[model samples]
Target: MNEKEILERAYLEAQKIVSENSFREFDTSLCENVDFLIDKIGSNKSIVSALATSLLKKITNPEQDIRLHRTDFENGYSARSLDTKVVTPFFKRHFPKYANKESAFLTLSTRERIKWNKNEGKNLKIRSKALKRSFLNVFEQIEDGNANPRVYLNYLFAKLQALSSKDELIFQLAKKQSGRSGVLNINLIIEMLQRHFAEKLSSRLPVVAIYSIYEILVPNLKRYDNKRLLPLQVHTSSDKHGFGDIEIYGDDGKPFEIIDIKHNISIDADLIFDIIKKTTTTSIDRYYILTTFPDGFETKEIEKAVNEFIIQTKTQKKIDIIANGIIPTLKYYLRFIDDYNLFIKKYTNNLVKDAKNSTEIKTFHIDKWIKILKEYKINNV
Candidate 1:
């Protein structure tokens, strides 16, 4: 299967598992062998992100499990010592009839025996709670980044990616990270989605959510007159470049509008400039920058950039940006597209090697990623 298919499959399986387990009525272990894959898959960027987030808490962290078991072993020795030093002597004194009786089963009022059993059980329950609280302290310490620094939690991410499971996507993510394998040819896909495609399930699934939105946005768009295509790939160099993930041209041979489906709740001036630069030739009537954030997405940056550009140009292009609040269908499956550290640059489908840090600079065209997204989905076309 292809990388896209594998990714979709992994996401669907994780979603299904999460949906079933969400009721607490059907909780069960995921058949996936990837140690952290299910948890990672469930976290953020779907309708059931909470389910995925809970998966982490439900399953024992591998490091914690090891430490807890080790503690149990250590406590076993201490407990055995207590049995010999404290418990044995105490029992001897309490059971006066046991001065010669080894078993302490000989003679006691039935009521007294019942009281002893109840007290012992209560004491054991209290001790059990104490041990749990002690172990829980260790768990909290680990979470707070106060534990041994070397025992990082992300090791679980690596281990989970390198799974021995029947799932194909787990293996694909492993390969992509390895650079030794992975099926999606970025040459065929796009630079941004390529990087997004390789991200953990939580990180990458938003792209799918956005894609589904794009599919229904513009009623009918076909590259050829006779053929109808649900999706069609326009070149990055085309004047029909979309402001976001998709751009559709009119049958009359002029750019109609550009839609930039953003996972980012808010866009800055620079991003607005980037989209403006792409649309300069198209002379598009309207630009729709749709973001999935309902409340936090700030549009002042784009507004400021547009005002500055308009004042400087001294021309009437009749251009404006509209920030549609959220995609209603996917509002529940919202994602916080971290615009700060979201992208990685590539030159000719390989890493851009420079003396300084090219990774630090956000220099790629969003239009290219949109094209790659289009190309991948143009299966029937």
Candidate 2:
């Protein structure tokens, strides 16, 4: 078999073994199939190797551990200002030149270094701000087709793997003292799959969300209407400012409302209020905020704020917030099809890798994504 076929076969075998067994117990007795797959690590690509190893380690399924992951702790896990007052002070005292950062020694790729610089700032709050900006920059690049989110995500996953590896003992020491709520003592895949991927993809959430929902709707529409809904350029910038992250086009293809998606462990009220204010300048129907944040009093408060905005300004558009739990499903769809297609299109070509085609469809089990949705507890959505 070709390398891709071999990698796919090994990946599937390992996944099937994990799927059929309880994750906690699955780790106790790695089956011969998975053991062999894990042993063939040197041959497969990084993603394939990572997936295979994840299967053996009981990391693929979300059921194994604390699943819903957050990107930042808001505070650096310690109210003592461990990140700023403690860590930064220590660095400034002894390693004033290096600031206790590794960048003083190693050379990071120009693009990669910018992301690195964001993590080391004056304080945790500043660091968080920088982190968010850097993430949005990458998200914009992903939206612009200038960068691949999966590749960036894999870079993060690789970091997690390094932290977990025996070779990285110092990280264990750091994790102990750092009360980083974002970094939990659980499976690496959970953080990578549920948190990193979820958070990053959510930045461009509307694009991927619409694409996933479109594909799902297309097959059903064909089954019922006996016609195909050909995909079109769903998003277009209204002008230099751009109409939020998404535009709800009317029948005439003019934007009717500005649409945006924000996925966070908890919804921040100021963000919603800011979004509502921006919609007032548009003649759209309403500003739509789609989020994965669980329903709560805060969500209701967001709705109440929009109502108050209508009462105060008497604008043409209103604000609608939906915290439907479909963000995870949307992310899964992107990973399987959209992101996969992007990865292949960017790195490979027509003569080489194609997951959407005939033989590959079976070899790769691309349609199995449907089964994942059905078999898994997507009812939360």
Candidate 3:
């Protein structure tokens, strides 16, 4: 079988084991090692990817004494391309949470492919010794034929599947608790949202909230209804085609407007210059730079640059550049939204689907809203 087919077969086998609970019969030191790695590793995906990639390579050619890592030389094949081209894409499709992080080999590709013995990679050095030892133990067992490779694969895949399930549960519970407090006061809603954004648990939270607000306001506003708001792009992705955090496509399938959100970062002349440079090629109707910064464009330099750019772009490109704080922007937008309750519902729903946001960020929104709304309800009574 081809390499991809072999990997697929193993994955399918692992899935079957996960479903039928048959892997419990084969549980051994290898399975425990995998559990320990997952527990200790926490969010470090590179090490997990490295472990999976090494196991796959070894499983493909059982005869070769596959080292933990190696490059294409007279001795053996390089795992770099396989990790980047094959394994990375596979993980992206099946496990999106880990997709943002790159494989260990991809990070180490710049250095000479010196065979790293004992499953050691440059990135693994910062991790705990138990994690390092667990990886080495698993690799040695698989290489020496002390443990069944297929069993190890089953445990790894099952462990990851279990983790995804646990995270999904948290997201769902958060969504369930994201109800409104009966009264629809724009001022109260805005205050609750401000509190949530101020926690600063994750930058992705503010972006998600802004995007959710746009999802409601864009369609209702007559001027923006003619345009379509683009979905949120992956946070770590670089190829944004000169668009900002939130993009609106015009009827002509071009960028109509762009909104970039900053979390507590100072907005200065240099920031405005960077924005102008990025949008030089696109003829956008409006560009907004909204921030949660305590001070809103405090310097004269920032104010002057914004005003001058607005004049030049309005005349030259017809793009109106506006900068403001997020709370004020939300207050203005919420004025137009018919039902403030819908904003809470949409925000909660978006939080569940946002893969880039961590579980902590999702829970923070729900917990903060719950506390705020309860207090509001009590005081009103």
Candidate 4:
């Protein structure tokens, strides 16, 4: 196919991929229109370059609204938002430095680093001129009509992979140490995911709460037909106690099962009883009390409570137990977040490199980061 045909087809394919997988709706019509122009121009490299130039202008102009929006009611919102805060800032700050330096070090044909000598009034102009120069340089190298499309695509993929690697390194380092730094790193990951990719993934609850629900439900979900489960937080009122937290539904959305997650040091018998009593009239299949302890606890204490509840109710609804020390789980989660932050940092740096390598400025890598938290062990009594 000619250059025009090639550009048109590639742009269309890119549009399809973005629309299908992107977390939000974007005006990919600019890309589509650019493709149409390329097709009309036939196969000249200059025409193809002009079309790409136009496409970049549209993407960078900020005329289109690319920001994602979602309702506050969803469970995934908070966690995802939290994750984004953790990752994006670090990436934005460090990306330019890393990319420019790396391009210089590697001596890549498509990458260049222009030195800017600062003078008080000339700082802005110098920086702007350097940026424009870098943008054009990278585009000229890649748009030669002979460079493999995969080369351009691979650049994007490589940056993402580097970021992931960097995150893993940071997490490992934190695992060996402790204090505020680790805590801050963990929080960063939570913030980054929440901000960027939370809307795309399922659940609108706070990430920690959602994770707690997932930890307890995953095994049960796997045991019973391997169905996907939805976590619900419901407040209920009973005849005696007025209103309290109760088990309202099972993993399968069935009426009979109820589960509650508590982050308290010890599970309160009165609270459990209150929940059970309130939920008594409802179609509760089973009752599960999942508690996370900062330090480990005796399962016997929880068993005693469960046994007492079972005897008192004399009801067929089974009582289950989930009691565990959550420090290790927290550690694991923190590690994941750190890794993600590092990933974003490195990825953004790569973009900076691309920007500095050309005279034509283009912005890329706009997808928000998403974290798929792994399931950890639960101490079942």
Candidate 5:
């Protein structure tokens, strides 16, 4: 079967298992095999993606041997390619939390003499011989046609569901707290949000929050009247043109302004150098390197380099580079916003829709905001 057909089949099977609760009847041994892998790997997503992709491909075409994952196996198809092109996309679409750019085969190299044969686990990075034996033993059953692939797939999906379960401590706390009722204090709200950012809920949360602020501020700012704020790119994305975390376009559709938000990381000379490379090619009018780090940029030498680079870029390329603390920038932007509620709503919506954020991160954002409102009595009745 083609990659698309196999992906569709896997999705259908997953839906069937989930909707009908068919995994309840999976054999204990099959479930135990997945458990063993999880215990050994401690929720290594790459291994899980690799195994799922291999099993789904096997079930799709049982006649073809899927032993050597990197090879085409004379079936006019490469399992590694299938993992990269098809399975990764499926993971992104159906299970965005575990989606990555490349395939798991990148880590599990089955090349040269190290084929997925009897000695497969020995060649792997697994240190213990017993663990290696257990690893091979699990796949041995599948390779020898002993374990039913469909049943195995059900158990695998079941194990993944268990691993992906959400934490509810914050949810419980939020439920018990009394809702506050009073007029909103913009300063208090900013302080609460700043504290939230300080918690470092997730690396993606700050970027999204910053983007949400820009979403509100950009339309009103006279300087951005002709400029357009670009859509927020996935935090894990690598190909964001030459711009940084956030990009603004001019009337000509070229990047006019860029902002790169760093989470709890000090901007040093190395980062400044990278920015220099990025700015050389684009005619961007301004670049902002905002960081959650209290110290902002690194040592005095690095700070000097940053200032010099800024002046150099401004003089040579007309590219203005400003390095500052993220929270302070947000606080300044909040002064321009008339309705602070809009900021909260935008941030909440972005958190809900962000594919990269875990359930804990999303719940914490809502719960923290709730806690802040109750403590400050900032909520409307």
Candidate 6:
């Protein structure tokens, strides 16, 4: 078989393996199998090896499963550790000629190797740092090789860390490469979404909460726009209320006509009325009340209530008013809860609130509000 034919077969087999497994351990471990398939079909070793390595790297390292350790205890004991150690075998498999067997014996030659001394107290900090540095050095050597798929894969993997930092350079780079003209890398897109959402929810809340929102919205955003919209929080104070949160703006740098966000069961109608009234005074073109309990309130009832409020504002003309709750679509809600739980785990108790009874609700459900705007055909310039 030709190179193309071998690649075709290997790709099909890899797809099958990925489909059968969970997202965690899907296609990452299929490097050997992919290479074997290519070899059996008489493909070029170098090209097939590169392709197989790329596929393996692409499918492996699900960010959701990346090990995050919190060493709060003395000597840096961490509850979060990987079950299996990840060893870079490229030096052994691909660069045996360069492997320095003598380096392993250098420590032995120095006679400095010593077993753990109970009285000496474990220097876990030094040990952990040294281990991490050693592993990184090996990775560097693997990456420095010829145009192997693993080299690019490793580069991409390292780039993933920058996404969390809200690094504009990294984001721009990913956006540039996301198109047909570029690398067409989905992992970069995912990393961008994760970081975008992470930064969005990072303020006034715990990292975990932001992460939860990201998990829920990232996949949905990918489904809708093939990218995530940067969410912005707008602060406004009403005359009636001393100070409050009002609207959320999209990346377009304009606040949406309508704003929607999750709230606790105990919602303050007075505050809601104040927000609606204050919004009218400002540039807000329309109003909406989005809640977690969509089914709990009748749409007609809220509509009637809103109409009454409009009548009360006799000075201003009647405006479109939308009040409804998101029904928590199966796919979107599940992802939201997963990311929310993760966020809660990483942040403070006050920053993370249960949906049961939290009064500090704000207007920032930008994604859902966007949907509502589209549904109503309401456009705000």
* lDDT by residue (tens digit), candidate 4, 120-165: 1122222334333333333333333233333332232233234434
TM-score of 2: 0.29
Predicted candidate 6 versus true structure: per-residue lDDT over 53-147, tens digit per residue: 33243234322111112244333212112111111133223222111222211222111222112222132222333332332232233333222
Whole-model lDDT, model 4: 0.33
Off by over 4 Å in 6: 1-230, 233-254, 266-271, 294-303, 310-318, 328-381
Model 5: how far is 21 from its true place, Å?
4.4
> Model 5: per-residue lDDT, tens digit, 181-290?
34555677677777676554556667877888889988989989898988776554322344787888999988888999888889776676678787776688888888
Error of 5 at 334 (Å): 1.3
The segments of candidate 2 whose C-alpha lies over 4 angstroms from its true place after superposition are: 1-207, 214-241, 251-253, 265-269, 296-303, 310-381
What C-alpha lDDT values do all the predictions have?
Answer: 0.33, 0.33, 0.68, 0.33, 0.66, 0.31
lDDT string for model 2 (113-140, tens) is: 1221233312222223433343333323
Q: Which residue ranges in model 5 land beyond 4 Å of their true spot?
A: 1-13, 19-22, 33-44, 63-65, 72-77, 101-138, 158-182, 237-242, 299-305, 356-381
Q: Which has the higher lDDT value, candidate number 2 or candidate number 3?
A: 3
In candidate 4 the C-alpha lDDT for residue 79 amounts to 19
Better of 1 and 3 by TM-score: 3
> Order the candidates by TM-score, highest first — what do you get?
3, 5, 2, 1, 4, 6
lDDT of 4 at 312: 61
For model 3, the run of ten residues with the poorest summed lDDT = 355-364
Cα error of candidate 4 at position 229, Å: 2.4
Q: Quick one: best lDDT, which candidate?
A: 3
| lDDT for each residue of candidate 1 in 164-263, tens digit (9 for 90 to 100) | 1222333233223323222343232333333443333222233333444333333333423332212322212211233454454566656665556555
What's each prediction's TM-score?
0.28, 0.29, 0.78, 0.26, 0.77, 0.24
Which one wins by TM-score: 1 or 2? 2
